[model samples]
Target: MSTDTSTAAAAGTQPGGGTAVQGHPGRLKPRASRPRRGPASYATVSAVAVFVLAFLAPFLIILVNAFKTSADYRSHGTLSLPSSWNWGILQDVWQRVDFTQKLLNSVETSLGVVVIAVVLALFNGYALGIGRIRWRTAFLVFFLGVNVLPQEGLVYPVYYLFKELGLYDSKLGYTLLVGVTYSAFGTYLLSSVYASFPRELIEAASLDGAGRWTILWRVILPMSWPTLSVMCIFFFVWSWNEFLYPLVLLISNENQTVPLGLAGMQGQYTSDPTAMSAAALLGVIPMVVFFLLFQRSLTRGLTAGAVK
Candidate 1:
């Protein structure tokens, strides 16, 4: 009995206070301690916090001031909270600017651009990346150059070109112009993505009697949908926020977009800051709501292509 007790004590007294498992010679090792965070980690966290605060500051200011009256804005200053929550200002601004029509116009233009641009980009990407067209590098470089060309420089030419085509000052003209311009970058982006697509899959599809179009529609598009979705979101948002082109091209108030509508609120001599803030807030709401709705898709699409 004493010998058995001594044997058990010896087995339990292993290195690092580990205990021997019953029916097994191996001992259970102690858990490792977590590493302490150094100053660098804290500094990184602090920098991220600062950036978040900076990004949120303007929106917070806008929110607070949107609820303030002109008198309250002047008295309490920009950062202070409003004495009363003036919900009527939003409605007032909406009615004053004919925002409902502007909202519809913006939505129409943005969606049109997304459809035209995504289709254009997909075709371009397939031809360049899969077709392996001659002068592909040169074509890509040209697209890059076009994307970098300032809109300011092209404004006059575009205006003249559209004027000649009898499309100037029309929503269709604006949509087509922006869509083509945006498609340059999209083409460049998607071509690179398509280049990395699996040749094995393409060959497999072909062996199964799939033509190029069939493969593109059935195989390539299915795999590439995530990237395409991301591009759609980007195109929509960018087109929605377009100001310079819309300002130059859209002459009729009936065809003007949200950004244009927002700009029209500012008077030459006596602009109401509070009302401007309210207008700004209204302009931002649609985009915010859009992002929220597509937030999951955006996140998934962004990471989908990263792995393969």
Candidate 2:
């Protein structure tokens, strides 16, 4: 009996241990400790704060200076507050810029572009995304051509075409031109988002007797709200801030976009620096509002597949 007991002890004992320690069969093993916040986290936060302040400083300067008169602005340092909040300067700029008209023109043009571009891109992206047509490769190649081709090269040709078609000063002409120009690149971008969609979802929809258009509108468009929001903001910003196209296409003051209208602030004899700053602030506010409004959607789109 003693020899049997000794043999059992020897079998149970680990080589490094004096005696075998039994664990509770039902109890889970303790996991390793997690890492605590350390130097790297603090360093990253501090760097981000510094970068944020640096970028905000210029915007602060613009905001403060927009309220000053040209004389007050020149007399006082840029960083200093004005003696008084000069409401007069804002009024002067509002009138001089014809800012209300310019704002309306910008909104109209942006919406028009958005409506047209999104429609065309949805069709293109849908065809390439799920249809799996033989022309998918050809379509991508064609869009690549449009995106890579410098708009500068097409300027003269488009200008002549518009002139011949009597679309030179028409808003419809500009709207169509900008819309078509955006479609190819927009389709290319949205296609990636579409590709990231689940093949299973598409198959399920089809099995339920959902047509292509039904699946696109019901399943795909709803799921792709983030990408669509981002695209809307992107297109709106580009169209609002576009200077070259307006400079070339819009000959009349009545048809000018905001950027071109703001550029008109630089006069032959005298420049109203305060008005210029104010006008610029006005121009930028829409874009800032747009970004802030759709920021969450953009963030969701960007981080969608990051976690698998």
Candidate 3:
């Protein structure tokens, strides 16, 4: 027993070393050290903060200048605060923008595009990805073609076609055009979701006498919600922020979207810089709110797609 005690002490073992040490049996161990964020880590953080501030500066300038009087803005520059806080300019800008009419037009048109695009995507993705559709490769190629073809190349023809149909200045025509244009993108995105679908589950469902429609409605849709949410976020942002289409197509205030209405702040000779800034600031608020609300959905959708 005395020899054993002497041996344990010489070996740097615990006093009651009957079993074994975790890392090296019968030996004492060093305590684990926590990792410290060094200069490299702090440099990365500093770089990120600088990048964020660079992007945020323009938004801050816009917000600050939006409240100033036109003269004050022109004199003091974008970075300076207003001498007199004219809070009522927003109310004036709101009316000038035809807020109610423009807002309604934007929402309706975006919703129309979303509905049309989502429906087209769902049906086409189902047929090509899951159904026994003939010439599936051809369908895939066609979808890819539509997406790759630059809208600029076909603008003249599309405009002529719409002109013949008396849809040159109509919101409905614009909605259909935008929807069809974006549907190709949506179909391609959703095809990936359908392609990765569980084959065994589909076979089992079929064996249970469940039809394709039932399988799609019950299984595919529920599983594909994350992808759908991602699509909605993209399509919504695109539709809301569309400028060129609405600019050319919407000729009047009654039918013009928010972007077009905001553009009206500029006159050929003189423009209200402050009012334009105010309108632009107001226009961005809804989209910002929307992104904030759906940020979690967007994150989850992206992560899910990445993992798959």
Candidate 4:
């Protein structure tokens, strides 16, 4: 009887007593929520940071060293700030390097290259990208073949050909060569961009009694501004930075573009670090400025209509 009473009390106490055990669902732990940083977002930020550092670091090195004397420059790390600023170096560079003339030449060459290349590329790319023709495959393959042909192999042939045609050592010759060399790849790049544009827009333009040339100029060119801007920057950069062709073709220092001018500076001073640094800095300044100005177009314009 006593045992039965104890058992009943134990059973009753299980639910009410603080230390009593009872079968109950374990209190669900509020799961600690994982912080959200979606993979793509993280990747994008990382890529941008990397790109910025890669571009800025070299230019920063130039800026820092541009102010240092040869002794200080040699002793210090390339990235280190100068011990003392020398504004006179820049002044000397400007006067001695004929920087004004060289800069103007570069501007003219780059602008001419950009304009001529893009104009021809627009027509050719539009035709090839949108136009259906029997020889389209053959023509594209041929252009690609031209692109693939070793540039070195072509240089001698081009030099000889230009000499025969009375085109060597002339600005006109350089402009023409740059334009032609660029067209094949420009056409190829623009073709990809043109392909992604809305077909319906083209059809509508065609239905409105527009001729192919008119449609291309009026509709296609305007719509392709993003890619066109990108191409302009690209061509300008390439023409400005071109060393080999300018070195080979430009016989006269007076006709020399900035890259050639920089090379000439090297010989003029026999590797005087101060002058060389100044010339190097001066040569790169315009391009760096141009790049910064067009940074928005290059990044934004690349993806303008890509999604839909």
Q: Which one wins on TM-score?
A: 1
lDDT of 4 by residue, 166-193 (tens): 9888777888888788888888877777
Model 3 spans > 4 angstroms off: 1-28, 306-308
TM-score of each: 0.92, 0.83, 0.88, 0.79
Clashes of 2: 0
Over 1-308, each residue of candidate 3 has an lDDT whose tens digit, in order, gives 88987787666675674433666665556556799999999999999999999998878877887889978987888788988888999999998778889999999999899989988998888877888478877777888899889767877787889889999989999999999889998887777668778899899989999998999898788888888888888998899999888877778779999888887888899887788888889898989998899999999988986775
lDDT by residue for model 1 (1-308), tens? 77766776686744445666666656564656899999999999999999999999999999999989998988989989999999999999999999999999999999999999999999999999988999999999999998999999999999999899999999999999999999999999999988988899999999999999999999999988899999999999999999999999998999999999999999799789999999999999999999999999999999996675
Q: How close to the true structure is residue 267 of candidate 3, measured as C-alpha lDDT?
A: 86
> Candidate 1 clashing pairs?
none
Backbone clash count, each prediction separately: 0, 0, 0, 0
Error (Å) of candidate 4 at residue 78 is 4.5
The TM-score of predicted model 3 comes to 0.88
lDDT of 4: 0.79
Error of 3 at 215 (Å): 1.1
- lDDT per model, in order? 0.92, 0.82, 0.85, 0.79
User: Which candidate, 2 or 3, would have the higher TM-score against the true structure?
Assistant: 3
**Model 1, TM vs. native:** 0.92
At residue 214, candidate 4 shows an lDDT of: 84
Q: After superposition, how far is residue 217 of candidate 1 from its true place, in Å?
A: 0.4
- What ranking of all candidate models by lDDT puts the best one first? 1, 3, 2, 4
